[model samples]
Target: MMRRYFQCLADRDAPAALRLCTELVEAGRSPVDVLLDVVAPAQHEVGRRWAAGEWTVAHEHAATAISESVAIALGARIPQPDPARGHVVLACAEREWHGLPARLVGFALQEAGWRTTFLGASTPPTQFARFLDDADADAVAISCSVAAALPAARRMIDASRETGLPVLVGGGAFGRDDTRAKALGATAWAPDARAAVRALESIAPPPAGPSVNRRAGIDEHAELVLRFAEFRDSARRRWAAVIGEDAATPLADDALDHALHSLSAALLTDDSRLLREADEWLSELYSARGGPSCAVPALWSALRAVVGEPLPEASRHLGLLRQVGRSAPRLI
Candidate 1:
């Protein structure tokens, strides 16, 4: 039953996650086990597919929200031991309002016998700093799904370090540059939130010895940098025009997430002209701006990543803008 449930999530089938959770509850399947195995692994699976472009961001989110809701249903059933190895504070950077991963980390950490404070995304840096000072957490784990929020992640890391707080940063951006993780002042970076639990355990007793490693030969992404720049800016302009500023600044996760997946049919079209058009359209997008739009920098960053090495800061800024998608509902 759990195996079938896992398959549904891998397929990004929302109804399956929810229905399976209900059945598992009825069948005496430990909610804790369901979340530990069924939800996290499934979430990771969907995330992997989304990265490979096999699934749209919307489908990934649908899978996430459904799984999160199920995890929430499990509730206090998540393990919580008084004798924890250490405590961690998890939050998203300001301007980055996605929090589903942090929420998942909160549950996953509990299962690992570590205490965690699930701080949702877009939290002000000042308040985040205060929380660390007050809570005296063993380490602070910051997350961001959108690449645009990375600078904010850097700021949070800087602020935490000023107070001697051990910090680890993770998310989509980290997926782009594991080395930039430390460059941003993070004590370390994890491929995923669950991996963070292992990172924390492996670090040591004090949990504050900061180690920075440069993953040599990790400096460039030619195609992403050169090819993606113009196209990314264009996409941002289209997104901004479609959603407008108010909706664009604080993107509607549900709407944008929905749009990404709904467009999968486009990905299925094999016409070379259509694909060429897609590529060319990105190049011409908002050409009047003279560069990539300010909205989706991460796409720019990820693109530059393909360019590899000697990546200038200007390129990162451009890529970050492309990370913003058409998440808002069109204002007709």
Candidate 2:
């Protein structure tokens, strides 16, 4: 039943997907089950297919749009309890644009009888605090889908604690376990919607402490990231120009954006492993597209030049990127 709905989503048939969802609901399937089981898995598959290059960004977007519609519909159909379980707020960490996962969790909580206020995506710490100022939320759940947003999550948790609300943090950024979330000072970590509900139910009141302003520690590569930012546009322009000269069909804006995003991700973490993975992914993507041999190298070189004096990790990534380019496929 879920498979057919997923197929409709993949085909970009929103009406069919909605019809399938309606049928499931009419057939006595739980709306929460539809959300957690059907829509969630379908969206996950869409992302998985995108990562594996089986689907383009467009396909992923189309699928996600359908799933989001289903999620909203499911939320509307779920009957709200009279008294409500409790009040909680859900928000994505600052700069975290991936909101669907958080939205699903919010819907799940709502279905479970919690009065949930979902703040949507990329919510800044100030905005989070401002929202808490007037609203009487029992707890706050911060979502971060990327490792890069961990710092923001930490600050959000701290801010929530200041408001006398126990903070429950979740999302992929916390890893398979709650270790990272615990380290970030969250009262509890919920890996999924069920766990989230449990955490909220058993949440203890915030410890009596001063309402001090706590900020996440400064990122180690902040300076390096700023340097990269200074020349980010220059790098993208150079990459496109090089790709244009070398390939019959120039690389798409999406591809160039991905290249810059990969570079930024590596810069953010100061992790050599991420840079290596980015290099490999870009190399393979270019190879599959049969783009110029110079494309990858040109990008790395432009990056290195922008850095002026490379940081220790930057040098390693630059070396790795150069190695990747040497074997990159060239268009005849």
Which candidate achieves the best lDDT against the true structure? 2
Best by TM-score: 2
* TM-score list, all predictions: 0.55, 0.71
lDDT of 1 by residue, 120-236 (tens): 769888888878778868878898765445546766887777777677777754544455575565777787646877777765332343332232212222223343445344544
lDDT, model 1, position 211? 34
lDDT of 1 at 43: 68
The TM-score measured for candidate 2 stands at 0.71
Local error of candidate 1 at residue 6 (angstroms): 8.3
- Candidate 1's clash total is 33
TM-score of 1: 0.55
Worst lDDT run of 10 residues, candidate 1, spans 262-271
